[model samples]
Target: MSPRKVSLMSRILVYVLVAIAALYLLLCVALFVFQRALIYFPQPSAYATPDNVLTLPVADANLQVSVRPHDGPKALLYFGGNAEDVSQNLPSFSAAFPDQAIYLLHYRGFGGSSGSPSEEAIARDALDLFDRVYAEHPQVAVVGRSLGTGVAIRLASQRPAARLILVTPYNSLLELGIRQYPMFPVKWLLKDTFDSAKYAAHISVPTLLIAAEHDEVIPRSSTVRLYGQFIQGVASMKVIAGVGHNSISESPEYLKLIGAGL
Candidate 1:
């Protein structure tokens, strides 16, 4: 090839590389700007009942906690998915575990809760809720699903939850983020990395991890890894067949296993 032709090709390659780099940079910037939107999917309360709603004041925010009050020391605290309306689960939970009082938390900015959602804020609020529940009810079990699994695991590790149940749980949001955005430095960029693996080692309570056999959102390996992080014999796993991540609750076995955990 002629020297002029070689020079032209080199210039073209430089321009293409610069364009690619610019696009990647733009993508990283957008990911940084709208990262929270990608993480927390806050929704309005689906089953709003003034009588059942308990207002718990967190710092600079009033969190809506749905309570099915029962006159007993047995209580169950539930933390739900990112976009879940936990109030909707009251009837089912009440029926499943009638003996225990139920309290379902609506994460910050979710349902009627004030302020925005973050890992730090949710963890703090959950710990506070657990403490309050523990005060009234000495025997308390905790349940979490999806995003709430991270919150529940953290609380279980920090507090004395009699039992812990995680439904369709992931190892960590950081792992999920890294998998979803392989080209980006997700661990560094992610502000709310819900790393449940960090807390799993500290959880010594009887723990049950329920996995969806057909889970499309969180990889089965992630759930297995999380289960392994727990001290052997402290955590047990159940994989319900013919269910995906969202539809796992629909399975009859789901409630049965949850009840068994308690």
Candidate 2:
């Protein structure tokens, strides 16, 4: 090859490399800047009636907790998914477990709650709610779905929740994020690790993990891995057939299984 052709080729190669490097840096910066937005999908509460709304001060934020107050020892505390409007499920929950009082938390920045949402903030809020509810209701069962599973697991491990139920659980947000963004350094970029697997090992109460047979959002393997982390005989997994991650709740047997677990 001529010397001029070799020089041109070298310059083109350098330009290509630089362009790729610049794109990568831009991606990293975007991930860092909007990480929280990627993790949390906050929305207003679906149920605004005075009968259902209860406010609790969580740190600096006044968290709105949806309550179905019943005078009894048995209570159910629920933490919902990222984009979920937990208040929408009130009717189903009330019908499913009419005997037990139910409390569903709207995470920070979600459902009209103040401040931003993070794994640490959500976990702290969950523990605070658990402690407060436990004071009144001795037999409190904790239920969590998707992102809330992390909060629930951590709370159950640290507190004395009578029964624990996880729906469409994952091993960890870090692991799932890594799988979703294999090309990037997800482990380093992800701020909300939500390592439920780490907390699962410490949970002492009877735990039931509800897994979707064809979960697309959270892989079935991830839920199974989380179930394995629990101490022997402490946790059991039940898979619902013909459902995906979000659709698991639509199944007729969804609430039935939860009632049975509790």
Candidate 3:
């Protein structure tokens, strides 16, 4: 209870608090740098255009794209996984709809495309890609899977897509970012967390939302919220049973639903 004894206790408490603060700072740093690891993503691979390949250049950017056009009248413009080199899906796409022209968007960073991957840049590219594709084929659909759902929703809100498909979707990356890094200032610190639900209801296209019951990355709650929010617009939803996020697209029953959508 004496002054000297109180001083010793205060000093020890100060040292302990300082150590704790330093550790928390390190955690915040980890949250920012390793945030991508918390989410599942696949890197891209080279795409060989054996059929017919054409290069389309976007204005004010270094990302001129090469698209392998299918021999058909109706076409599809697709945004793929954040980490995915979407060109790798071309063979599966060819098999799925051999008659429809497919434009697999090479995202800014993925598929050797130029620029960095930010939410705004991807959304802008989505709109630009849609505009370009729509000019060529007026009756075209937009397909987005995983991270691309944000891109798809943004594009649909701005333009008219014949059909809009979202696979393993989320409501907002901002929400997820905060959840993963509560100690850090996620809202201010995060460079991009595309929130698709905010703009879903405004889209009037024939929308389709597909999610698995056991989605591990983006929760089913967010996907359902997005679907429910689309009540103002024309929308339909399909849930694949006994499947997780990544495997849902590969499910036979899920593909049957896709066949119906096409």
Candidate 4:
């Protein structure tokens, strides 16, 4: 290459490298300043499960849990949305799994629970709750929706579940991180990257995955990619035709999917 061209190319490369290094440093400073926001996954009171509901005491916090059994002798443990009030789903869960007992896990710092919530802590709480609930139930199935899918997959991977069901799931938090922070260097900055797709395929259980065609938060493509990761023969996938992320449960197709899968 000519000397002039080489000098220009080297200068551009230097500037690019300097920009990347500066961005990395800024990300570290931002994360450190907002560490509490990242670590403490708090939900608003509007999404609280129920003040009158029962609580299962965890190590440093408590979990709001509701148990309902139907005519059948089976059981289902349902995890809800990130900012959702799990108590709102209790009625539907009770109706759908009328023959089986159901337990709902409220995330830490959500509902009436205490303590902070992060990826590790939420997964830990889920596994612990599964142990307690599994002891009292048979044919236990674990279900997760949206953000809780991470906790569910972690628990299902470690525990013995008759089935693992995920609704409107994602490939990983890193994927979502890229979407929300396109310009930021998220892979290094993220403290919790819930990669359900990584664990879903390895989970040794009958699995059912449901995605909404019109999901707003998690793109249909992301859910589809995650669903694709499931091992063959042991897993199944379905989608609610017109439903979005929040209203997947409201769709008749979704109810049918859950009913048939269970």
Candidate 5:
């Protein structure tokens, strides 16, 4: 080929490479800016009434808690999945633990709670909720499911929880994000990396880590890794057979296992 033709080919190749690089950078920026949107899918409460709901006043937001009030020392505080309306769990929790009080948190921006949801914001809210609940109910069990598992574990580590229960839990949201988006720089882009494993080592209370046999959202390997983080004899794990991540609670053994843990 002539030198002029070779030079033309080189120029075309450079243009293509530059365009690819520019597109990749734009994609990364988009991921970084809107990452929280991918993480939290806020849902409206199904059962929000004056009789059952309790308003928790925080620094910036007034959080809503779905409560089944029982005049006793035993209470259960629940943090639910990202998209879950925690109020939905009230009936089942009330039925299962008739003697114990139940309080399911509506994360900020979820279930009529004000302000936006973020890892730091939710963590603060969880701690506040625990403190208030503990004032009345000395024997309080902290229960978290899916995304809330991260919140529960952190709270259990810092507070004097009587019992801790995690359902469909993961080692860390950072690891999960990388697994789902391998091509992206999730570590750098993710704003709210719920690193449950970091807090797991600090937990001293009797804990139960529940895994769904066929959980599609959280890998079994992730759950096993998290289980290993807890001090030996401090935590125990149970796998509910023939159930997916969302459907595990529907199983007969679900409530039985939770009640047994408490």
Candidate 6:
């Protein structure tokens, strides 16, 4: 090839490389800006009525707590998944634990709650709700499912929870994000890295880690890793047979395992 032809080929290669670099930068920016949208999917309350709803006034938001009020010192405080309408569990919880009072929190922007949802904001709300509930019901059991497992574990670490239950929980959201989008730098870009393992070591109460046998969302390895974080005698794990992540609660053993923990 002539010298002029070699020079032209080099110029074309440079241009292609620049275009690829520019597109990669744009993709990273989009992921950073809209990351929260990928995490939280707020839903309306299915049972939002005067009889079932309790309004919790916080500094920046008014959170909704779906309640099954019972007159007892024994109470259950529940935190649900990102996209879950927690009110849907009221009937089942009421039937299973008839003697205990139930309080299922609706994270901000979910189930008629005001303001946006974030890790910091939800943490504050969870602390406030636990304090309020503990004032009335001294023996409070904390139960969290999926996204809420992160919330529940952290709360149990900081508060004096009588019992702790985590359902379909992951070791860390950051790790899951990295697995889902390996091309990106998830460790640096993730703002709400729910590292439940970090909080798991701090937990001292009787705890239950529930896993679905065929969970497609959270890997069994992640659940097992979290279980190992707890002290030798602090936590116990149970896997419900013939269930997926979403369908685990439908199993009869689900409530039984939770009740057994309490």
Rank all candidate structures by their lDDT, best first, as comma-separated numbers.
5, 6, 1, 2, 4, 3
> Could you tell which candidate, 4 or 5, scores higher by lDDT?
5
**Which candidate do you rate higher for lDDT, 1 or 3?**
1
Worst 10 residues of 4 by lDDT: 43-52
Candidate 5 lDDT at 152 equals 98
Residue lDDT tens for model 5, 126-241: 99999999999999999999999999999998899999999999999999999999999999899999999999999999999999999999999999999999999999999999
**lDDT, each prediction:** 0.93, 0.91, 0.76, 0.77, 0.96, 0.95
Which should have the higher TM-score, number 4 or number 5?
Answer: 5
| Model 5 residue pairs with clashes | none
lDDT of candidate 6 over 1-262, digit per residue (tens): 9999999999999999999999998999999989999999999999999999999999999999999998879999999998999999999999999988999999999999999999989999999999999999999999999999999999999999999999999999998999999999999899999999999989999999999999999999999999999999999999999999999999999999988888
Per-residue error for 242 in candidate 3, Å, reads 1.6
List the candidate 5 regions with Cα displacement exceeding 4 Å: none
Candidate 4: pairs in clash:
70-98, 70-99, 71-98, 71-99, 72-99
lDDT per residue for candidate 1 within 136-250, as digits (tens), equals 9999999999999999999999998999999999999999999999999887789988899999999999999999999999999999999989998999999999999999999
Superposed Cα deviation of residue 162, candidate 6 (Å): 0.2
Q: Candidate 1's error at 228, in angstroms? A: 0.9
Q: Pick the winner on lDDT between candidates 1 and 4.
A: 1
Kindly report the root-mean-square deviation of model 2 from the true structure over all alpha carbons: 1.0
Specify the poorest-scoring 10-residue window by lDDT in model 6: 68-77
| Candidate 4 local lDDT, 25-52, one digit each (tens) | 8887897467547534555433233442
Candidate 4 residue runs with Cα over 4 Å from true position: 1-28, 31-52, 69-73
Error of 4 at 41 (Å): 6.0
List TM-score per model, in order: 0.96, 0.97, 0.87, 0.82, 0.98, 0.98
Model 6 scores a C-alpha lDDT of 0.95
